[model samples]
Target: MNQPHQPSRRILLKSAAATTAALAVGTAAAPALAAPGDTATAAAAPGGFPDYRYVKTLLKPSQLTYNPTGEIIFPCIRGTAGRLSAPLGRYYLYYAPHDAPGGICLAYGDHIEGPFTEYPRNPLVANVWQPHYSVSHVSSPHVMWNESAKEMWLYFHGENTTTRLARSKDGITFTYDKVVLSTSMLPAGTTETSYARVFPYELPSKNAHFVMLFMLNNTTNHRDIHWGWSADGRNWTFDQKALVSHNDVSAVNIGGPHLLTRGGSAFVVYNKDKTSGGDLMITEVGADFTLRRHLGRFYESAAGAPDNGRSASPSFGTEGGVPYMVYESGERLQGSISVARG
Candidate 1:
């Protein structure tokens, strides 16, 4: 089912000067300034506000049995399926489907609201990692579960100004690890640096365990939100300014960043894109990321439903305690991969 085309962010604006001179030869180092104090205690588990209004459509693209060019989007969930010396399912649902053979897929469910099951040898991670390089398509996927490397890291993107890293002890075979973030590590008119999301916070004096939130895309194409800091999630360092912009949400740009801690307080739950529609916003992430504060509308686009107005790349989770999200509902390469709960 590969006919509908054009959308890999316009094939990363026609190869962005052919991968910007090999992406400035491994650039990623220049983010040192995390010493202001008081702010580092968000182990994520208070989950107070979540009124995602009971939406549905859990996975579509005609319920893929293995479909590409179908437009499923970035929705990362994991409560298990790592640390696996045996089991392959208890929950784990990373997704993809951007276009042009776009991949990095997987699905399995015991329940996180799912009848999910798709991994009949699915893309797993494609666009050729052959002798160690190849691109044209690979979409946004973000998985995490590295309790000191028991394993499963997997952030993704391909040629949309790069972001990569892979590793897995289980959670289905991956190993490519490197090129942790690109667009020459951001800023100089940036130009597309994929949608990422990684968390395990602890920074202010540094020895940073890990923290990343992405989506850049400048040179006038707008789009904001940026950050990086990793002691060892596979070497990363980037902060060339912008932890959320479009002047901090007057909105025409802002992107799909999700790092919602709630109750230990640390937020950056994004997606604002507005000519008049797209919502899901919230800010308040202080200390060292340099304090931002734009808390407004955490979900909006219900009127006609099916998110035709836009609700983008989100991915929050909680189960026995309830809260849930997992978004990207419609428009933007024509979407679907929904779920809301509170």
Candidate 2:
């Protein structure tokens, strides 16, 4: 992800009663920040889970068949092909180059370890949607399949302040939905809201079927993680507070949150910019929107890894039950898609 114009830029709760109350109204005030040198209430947990071992560069900007000039960053994978339209392939790899005119692009392969082909026309979605709206660029593509609607849900952002949604039955042609998230929903000092990922989760309310986690840039110019809840996957409501902050992990900035469930407990796997080679960190969230503990670094690149001593923006997947992570490996704004498995 790029430096937010020099500006800015999830898990279950443990308390059942608190979770129920928060879910009922679709909002929860984040717990107060801990004092300096403290990480909420507990020490950093040791070791990362799924223990990602470096794989290979899945896609590089220079390797793209079309518009291969810029960097390629965020990666989201869906196992099944589109239901209402012809299959693009058995698997769809959604990614985008986080540069000006950052286009939401697509590529496909028969296997997770892809000898993938980019969409011939390229840039499935662009910054300008004509009559709807326009911006300098649009990037950070995260995709999910809506089973009931039989459509693909694409979430992305532009101009930093807004995160928009679009739906496509064919997974190729999309119709603009709405701006599901913006900085206005967050606290007063929030400057930007972007990099959102939506997942199906069991919240306590009957109307809510999904949860969203994203980055929030504050007045201090430090980035933190914030979240929202959704009913029917289209409409959303947010918490006025942050889910995780730079102070929570003693980092200058923190972002890129992906939900990971292990042993029936939910944890958020994210990256923090405290080191030159940014390390992926994990934290446990409770039933009341309370951040429980700061899990320590899981994956930090060695001196010569393809991540080039830098890694950020991770999305997880499994091939035959073997877990893996696809992440931005290279320099921050200028990166390539690299993979790792354990």
Off by over 4 Å in 1: 1-59, 66-120, 123-141, 144-152, 155-166, 169-196, 199-204, 212-267, 271-278, 284-292, 295-306, 314-327, 330-342
TM-score, cand. 1 vs. native: 0.32
Q: Each candidate: how many clashes?
A: 0, 5
Each prediction's whole-model lDDT (CA): 0.70, 0.71
- Deviating ranges (above 4 Å) for candidate 2: 1-48, 81-85, 205-207, 274-277
Clash pairs detected, candidate 1: none
lDDT of 2: 0.71
- Write down the TM-score for model 2: 0.83
TM-score of each: 0.32, 0.83
Candidate 1 lDDT tens digits, 1-342 = 101111211111123343343232211111111123422221111222434553467788777877857677888877663246555566678888888778888887766668778878988889888877798888888887778877878989888898888888886789887889989877687888998888778785777988999989878887888888888878888889888887767887878788765345577878887464687777887655677777677777654457777888888664433445778877777777876654
lDDT, residue 194, candidate 2: 92
Clashing pairs in 2: 12-286, 13-286, 13-287, 14-286, 14-287
